[model samples]
Every structure is written in structure tokens, then in C-alpha cells.
Target: MRECDPRIVLGLHRSRYERRILTSALDLGVDAIDTSFNYHGFSAHTALATAGSDLLPRFKISTKVGFFPTAGQAEHSLDPDRLREAVERSIRDLGRAPDLVFLHNPERSLTGSSAAAQDRLGMACAAVERAAAEGLCGGWGISSWDPRPLPRLVDGTLPRPDAVMVRAGLLAGIDVLEASEALAARWDLNPSQLWGMSPFGGSATQPLWGKLDPRVFIQSPHDGLSAVQATFRVAYWLPRVGRISVGTDSPTHLGELVDALRYEANLDNLSTYRRLLCEQRDRQPL
Candidate 1:
């Protein structure tokens, strides 16, 4: 088995939850797995326990809550009682408390005025925070697909999350990158406290990946790394996140992701790219 590397997380958001993938992850040093209460049709935790209860302890597990089953449909909720119950249920299903659990897009249920949103968000965070404190999980966090409204709601009164996960990659727009940064700053989070997800905008096989040469973002453009690997590596600098959650069932594919980390990102090009993104955003109609 390879030494564990925490940087590359095996995200189960779009996973098959196969036993082979879990074993492959352990072999490749990608020991951290990110999943959710509602994944695989709300059976993710049980599936994980069934597939690799023995391997679960070997991996650092992170998961999400906030979506519940309603009449056989998934519904978003921030009700503290419901959220608290979910955390407990997650522990039961996984057969172990998760190392970290996120609010799972609190922004989805955050509708109405800013103050109302703030109130909803604060209460929801507090509930998860209490769960972590109670040993229901190791820690609590916030995972936002679109973090635009979160920064403003964070103030002295809101319960602080241990970490934050946001979308990262070349596809992550200026609005998302800036908002994620702003939220991190508001919470006084270091780079390590921030995690990124959906590095390929949900899939690497998209036609857009064929159009753009991702090597432009790498410092050494001729190292024989595939463009998909280059795009994954560049994701770390897109918003300066320390850990990125990527999903792949193939061990070969997982090894490719781990190997991509060896290449250094061209910070100068990334800086220039961010500047261009901001400039273009500024020119757009609000």
C-alpha cells in the first residue's frame, strides 16, 4: 500500500460505490472519501458499510447532510431537529461517525431576504456544530456549490464551520471563486480549511475539454501529462484550495490523479487568468 496522501479525495457524489474502487483508493494513497447522506439514492452510507466496512476505518470520511427524503423525493431542509437527526442517522448507517460532515449547500434552502437567510443559515450551522461537539461526527463544515450569498451572512453571530468546500477548476467562474474566497476570509479560514469539489464541472469527458488546451495553466507544459490531469492540477490554484475532491472508479484513473500532483502550477499564469476573469466579469451586464 502507498503512503496516504490527503490532497486528493475520492468523492462519492457520482460514484458507483464499488469495493474495488475503495481498495484501489487505499492502494493509491487516496484514502480520503467524500460522500453524502443523500447520495446513491440515500443509500450511500449503507452501501459503503456493505462494500467496505473493513476499509472505511482506513479512510478519512467526509459527508454531507441537509437533504432529506420526502414522499420518495429528495427535499432540502435546514430544520435543526431534522438536521441533527440526519447526523445521528449518518453515524448509524456508516457504522462510524464521519471525520467531517458538511451542511451540503445550505444556500439551497436560503431564500427570502438577507436577514432571513442569515437566520436560517446561522441556525443550521449551529445544529451541525452541536453534532460535531457531541461526537456524532469529528467536525462540521459548509459545502456550497454556489457560495455567492454566504459571505454576507457570515457575521459574529453565525456558528463558524470547521471547513468549507466549493466548486473548483478552470470552469469555476469569477463570481464563484471570489465568493468562495470572501466566505473563507469572513470565517478566517486558511487554505487547508478550504476544500474544493466538482473539479471537472461534473465530468472530464465533456466536449469543452477537447477544445481548450489545459497545458497552458501548467508550469511545465511538455511533461506528457494528459489534459484532464492538467485541468485537475490547475484546479488547486483556481481558488487556492488545499484539498480537491474528485470521483473516479478506476484505479488507473485514480493513480493518474495522484501523479498529477507532482507537477507545479504556474502561479503567474493563474494570477493573470484570474485577473482576466475579473475583468471580463466587470464588463458583463449585472
Candidate 2:
């Protein structure tokens, strides 16, 4: 087996939940995977258990809660009791507790006045925190697709997460990047305590990847790197997270991502790019 690489997390949000990919991840040294309670029609945990009950123990699994099934449609909720129940159910479905459990886009359910929003977010975080304390899961985190609403809501009183996962990549934009950093700082989290998700903003096949030369973000002699691979490498520095969760069912593609890590990032280019992003974009495009 290949030695485990701590940096790459196989995000199962878009996965087919196949056994071969799980085996491939282990063989490729990608020993971590991130999923959500609501993924794959809320059958993700069960499917994972079914596909590779034995393999689950080989990987460090991270998953999200807060979204639940309702009347055949998924709905977001921050109710403490409901959140705790989700954690319990996830353990039952997966046949094991996840290594880390994220609050899962808490922003989606945070609405109303600022004070009210803060209260809701804090209680939800506490519920997961309690689950972790009770051994319902190994640890707790907050995975935010859009982290803008979070930094402001975070303060000393809020229950800090073991880590915070946010969007990272050329497409992450300046606003979310800064917000993720700010939130981590408020919680006194170091880089290793921060994580990145959706490095390609959900897909590597998007038209945008083909148009840009992402190698600019990497220190040269990297002419051999593919633009897609270059983008994955640069994602590590985009928001400066320790681990990044990306998805793919193909083992070859997964290997390509692991190989991209050999190239070092061009911090100067990344800095300049961030400056330009700050100058032009104050908000993410709708």
C-alpha cells in the first residue's frame, strides 16, 4: 500500500459510492474521505457500508450533518435535538462513527436578525460538540460552501470546531477566501485545523479550467503539469488550508491529483492574484 498523504481528502459528495474507488484511494495513499449526511439521497453512509464495510476502517472519514430528508426532499435545520439525532443516525447507518463530523453549511439555515442567527449557529455547533464528547463521532468541524455569513457570527462564546472546511481554488474568489481565514483566526485554529473543499468548485471538467493556464500559480519547471492538475496544486495555497477534499470516481484522475502535489505553489503569483481579486470582486457572482 502507498504511504498515506495527509493533504488530499477524497470528497464523496459527487461520488458513485463505488468499492473500487475506495480501494483505489487506499492504494493511492489518499486515506481520507469527506461525505455528508444528505449525500446520495441520504443513503451515503449505508451505501458506503454496503460497498466497503471493511474499507471504511481504512480511511479517516469526515461527514456533515444539519440537512435531513423531509417528504422526499432534503431540508436544512439547525435544531439542536435534530442535529444530535442526525449524528446518532449517521453512526447507525455507517456502522461506525466518522473521524470528523462537520456542521454542514450552517449558513443555509442561519436566517433572521444577526443576534438570532448567532444564537442558532452556536446551539447547532454545541450539539455536534456534544456528540463528539459523547463519542458519537471522533471530532466536529464546520464545512461551509460559502463562509461569508460565518466569520461575523463567530466569537469567543461560540463552540469552536476542531476544524473548518471552506471552498478553495482559483474560483473561490477573494471574499470567501478571506472569510475562511478570518473564521479560523477567530477560533484560534492553525492551518492544520483548517480544510478546503470543492477545489475545482465542484468539477474539473468545467469550461473555465480549459481557458486558464493554472501553472502560473505553481513555481516553475512545472511545464509538464496539466492545467487541471496545476489548479489542484494551487488550491492548497488559495486559502492556506492543511487538507483539501476533492472528488473523482476514477483512480487515474485521483493519481493525477496526487502527482500534482510534487510541484510547489508560486506564492508571489498567488499573492498578486489575490490582490487583483480583492480589487475587482467584493462579492461572489450570483
Candidate 3:
């Protein structure tokens, strides 16, 4: 919701609208918040801390690093200074150590090549190490679009991360089912626990506000509304799959998340979900 609306950013940072909205959203059973070091110039951290009396035990917060200027300067370069600044400010703003601090890397033009990606990945790793040493977070990790290269990139050289967040929706690169299983096997991770961000892609048609309706996603095949079902289905079958951490550049998507969770109560739909997984696997290009 914060990403989707400039108003949301404004409301959270400059006005009182967010307090009521946030309280309501938190009441809706969201177990966590993946906030940023740069969001709303520390107000997010402040609100979370102040609201802790009301919301802390209910929702875990996972903040990010590497971005700057919060709203407009998201794609800026990742540097040690920016990284350290974010960590210190976040700990101060939130008034507590974050449960997790993700070493965020916005999609850079350099990610396609092995050397550039590793260099970029290395910077993130160093930032995490710095934050961890300072006791700003419980653990540090990376978020990736593709996990195919992750094992090679992160497996042996640096300290093993406690967690990894990645994109695994139908619109994403990896085979969702296989990716979940492989990550668990290779990393000795619980597939259920991996953070699944942007189950939908950043397509324009997805609404940013109002009651979220999945039907609105019909135009964009890769929208989060479309992918969340796949995410839910996969998790239903892969019960060990941990929390489905979702984010959006739109508030309507937040509403969609609420709608999805409303009906996703049953965990016994394994047979149908397995069929869906097999269908996706068969359709992947060689």
C-alpha cells in the first residue's frame, strides 16, 4: 500500500490518514511488514515503534537497505555509506532491532552478467555483514529475481545468510515448484519459510487503491493478483513453504491480498495444486 500510492507515502509521512489505515490493515491479519530504511524519512519506523504498543506482537517487520531518498531515489547505487546510514537510522527510527534486514538490490542493468551481478551481490553482502556486526538486525540476507544463480553466487564464499527472499510467481523466471524444492535442498532451508516477494509482476493495469479484486488482474497475466493464486496453491501443497511475503507498488493489491487470504483458509487442496504445478512445469520452455 505504501508503494502504490504517493498519497499513502504522504499520508504516512505528512498526515494522519495512514494511522487509521495502517491500524485497519494490521488488524486484517497481516503477519509482517517488509518496510525500507528510506521509507517516509523515518516516519514508518517511528509509527511502527509508537504503534508497537498496539501492533508489535502481531506483525514482524523486515526492513531493507541500499535504496536512498525513500520515494524518488529508489534505484540509486548501493554503497557502504548509504548502507550504514540506513542501518543506523532504521534502528533508531524503529526504536528496536528489526527482525530481519534485507540487503535490497533494485534491478540494475548490470545483473545479467555474472561478474557485474556478483560485484553487486558482494556489495550487498558486505552491507549485511556490517549491519549484523552492529546488532541492528536479527539476520541479513538477499532478495533475488532468479535463484538459479544464487547458490553459486552465495553458497560458499560469504557467511551463509539466515534467509533469502526471492520472486517465484508464475510470471517470474524460475519454475515455482522446482525453485521452492531446490532452494530447500541446496540451502537446507524450509521452502515454506522463504520470502516470496511480488508474486505478481509490476504491470500497469493492477489497481493501486480501493477494494482489491482479482478480476482486475485479467489484463496483466503477470500481475500479483494472478500470481498470488499460484503462490497460494504451491504453498498449500508444499506445506513447509513459509510465509508468503508480498509487496506492491499499488494499494489495491493490498486489498487483493486481503481478499485472497479470506478464502485461502483450506490447506487440504493438495491434489489440485499438484496438478497446477505439473501444468506449469510442462509449459516451461526448454
Identify the leading candidate in terms of TM-score: 1
Sliding window of 10 residues with minimal summed lDDT for model 2:
277-286
Runs of candidate 2 with Cα error greater than 4 angstroms are 282-286
Cα deviation of 263, candidate 2, in Å: 0.9
Tens digits of per-residue lDDT for model 3, 234-267: 4323324455555443445455555544333333
**Native-structure RMSD, model 3:** 8.2
TM-scores, in order shown?
Answer: 0.98, 0.97, 0.61
Model 3's lDDT to the true fold?
A: 0.55
Residue pairs of candidate 2 with colliding backbone atoms: none
Mind giving the per-residue lDDT tens digits that candidate 1 earns over 1-286? 8888889999998788899999999888888999999999999999999999999998999999999999999999999999999999999999999999999999999999999999999899999999999889999999999999999999989888889999999999999999999999999999999999888998899988889888888987447888899999999987889999999988898899999998988888889999999899889897
**Native-referenced Cα lDDT, model 2:** 0.92
Q: Kindly give the stretch of ten consecutive residues in candidate 1 with the minimal lDDT sum.
A: 214-223
Q: Which residue runs of candidate 1 sit more than 4 Å off their true CA positions?
A: none
For model 1 the TM-score comes to 0.98
**TM-score of predicted model 3?**
0.61
Model 2 Cα shift for residue 262 (angstroms): 1.1
